[model samples]
Target: MSSNSSIKCTVKKPVEVKISDTKSSLCSGLSIVDLSFPNNSEKGIQQIESISFKNAYTAFLTIKVKSEQNSSSTGGKWKMCLHRYQLMTSPHYESGSQDYFKIPSSQMLFVPQDVVSVRLILQQPSSAWNQFGIEQVSIETPTENTNEEEAISKWLQQHLNLNSTVKKKIENVEVDEVSGGLHRMWALTETVKAQQTSASLGRYEVDDSYEINLLSYT
Candidate 1:
């Protein structure tokens, strides 16, 4: 896989997405933000993944982070962990509060303090919101205690199912460079974790065990 440091961050700043006033067809839109910001601020794109349900649409928010060796940064320790932020959709109020689509799990892992990315995926196959638009999206950096591996691990263990035949390994960590010297991000990979890979890299994960959560702020 290719690696690079980027300027991206999870936008803690929340924005509003207007909800439909009347009954609309099932449709989904996509939203994304810069995951790598402040530190190694680089703009990246967020792509859409399949939805969990046929009736429900799905979108994604993404940020880019490189290894410390990839870029330069002063943040230490909790540099690589999940960061938290809120996303507010609904230009108008949905019962006084803007409609919020929550990521089943909050806090994306490994996003640097300053640099993060966010993206949205629209799954309105019914074309109800072919022109869906989010009025505003806000983002900000999380605090020092954002890392919640124990909680996340517990959650994963409870939700994730382990397989006996899956071969997993913890690969060596590689540090890459950001677009500029603005900030640094951490990129980590494990055999247990599943993502797309090239034929040259071998094949996709054979096990269907654990899952991960990620998002970006606007």
Candidate 2:
């Protein structure tokens, strides 16, 4: 069986972001802003495609996920997916302030499955900025069409079950050498023709009147 087929599947829904009520500060001068997903279903999130958010004076960001091994289980442990990821080049400056950012799945340490909740820990080391937090936070996952296409492709591959002889025959198929040479020659001629630019009359005004409206600088 394929690796994808071996993994457990669940019903997926849109993820919602909610600000956690519990707020606290660390002794290391780090301002914490906690965010959670309130509308996650019992099955929880299956996959994460990307995460987008607007930074608000936040220099660094840390992400953690809470997931349950079994949906029936009431408890789950927290796992760190992103640790002390830089959000800005300079904390004191407004380089990345209020700027939108999208972190793709490739950057994540690991893609968590059956994610019950997500936590975002924002930090601003410098005291120069009094306020710091993330805005317009959103989590994106693979669409239903993507999953459907994958399933269809897998099913087709499995059902077809082509033999090595047939596969070798298909792979060994060759194109007509004459036709290939003609195509290459045609392509080269088209490229040469495209490089030769046509010259036009340098006339801008039509009958001593401008074609476009002239801007009046007051």
Candidate 3:
């Protein structure tokens, strides 16, 4: 008797979410117009859903950075973003879907400890992408006592100290960029306030997070 091999659907198929970059409220950054902001009382974290995007294919993600701006005239300054995320286990990185982001290394003293939040605007309009899945995102805590390497590191040390340089350079291992075949990136800007643009950032998970490899037939 002859036996035949069978195809397995249990190959851990990607958690398909059919993300329409244009239909969701994922334009340049945080706005008082759309996005259902989740309660951010858990320290400093928030999750929003039902964000619409006109740049469907170019539809990236964004993080609304709500800086504690005082007064109504100068209230919370909102900026959206994307961050370079590295899994504790995996070496691959998660980042913007554009070309290259002029992201400053974590070593800058002037940049706040919370400037990772950026607006995710796409160069194209109303597009769709195969977002595998995001597991968890949480607020980054400031750590203490990290050693320095380059001359700039010493400069930061002289100005602010070891922690300053440590905070700047997260890790320099060039991970797989998302802008080539299956990825892209956006232009880096510091508009502070603008009418149109987009960006992205990470959201901490309540529990565990995992990374998985994905392939798209579409």
Q: Count the backbone clashes (under 3 Å) in each candidate.
A: 78, 0, 53
**Which portions of model 3 miss their true places by more than 4 Å?**
1-64, 70-73, 79-110, 113-135, 146-218
Residues 1-218 of candidate 2 have per-residue lDDT tens digits of: 21221122222232323334558533343544444445555667777666788888889988877776633464465778899989889888888878999887689898877777677777777878766777777777765455667889987676556566666665676768667998999999999999987965434555666555442331
Ranking of models by lDDT: 2, 1, 3
Q: Judge candidate 3 at residue 187 and give its lDDT.
A: 31
Task: Put down candidate 1 lDDT per residue, 1-218, tens digits, no spaces.
Answer: 22222223344432324446468632234333222336433432222111111112222233334334333454422232323222323323223122444222234443332222333322222233334333333343322343477668766665544532331221222334333332422233343345656545313323443223211221
Tell me the TM-score of each prediction against the true structure: 0.24, 0.53, 0.24
**Which ten residues in a row are the worst by lDDT in model 1?**
47-56
Model 3 global lDDT (CA atoms, 0 to 1): 0.31
Supply the TM-score for candidate 2: 0.53
Model 2: pairs clashing at backbone N, Cα or C within 3 Å? none
Model 2 poorest 10 in a row by lDDT: 2-11
Model 3, span 115-197: residue lDDT tens: 21323322222224333222112223323344445566768657665565565564543456434523432333323345454
Per-prediction RMSD in angstroms? 29.3, 17.8, 34.0
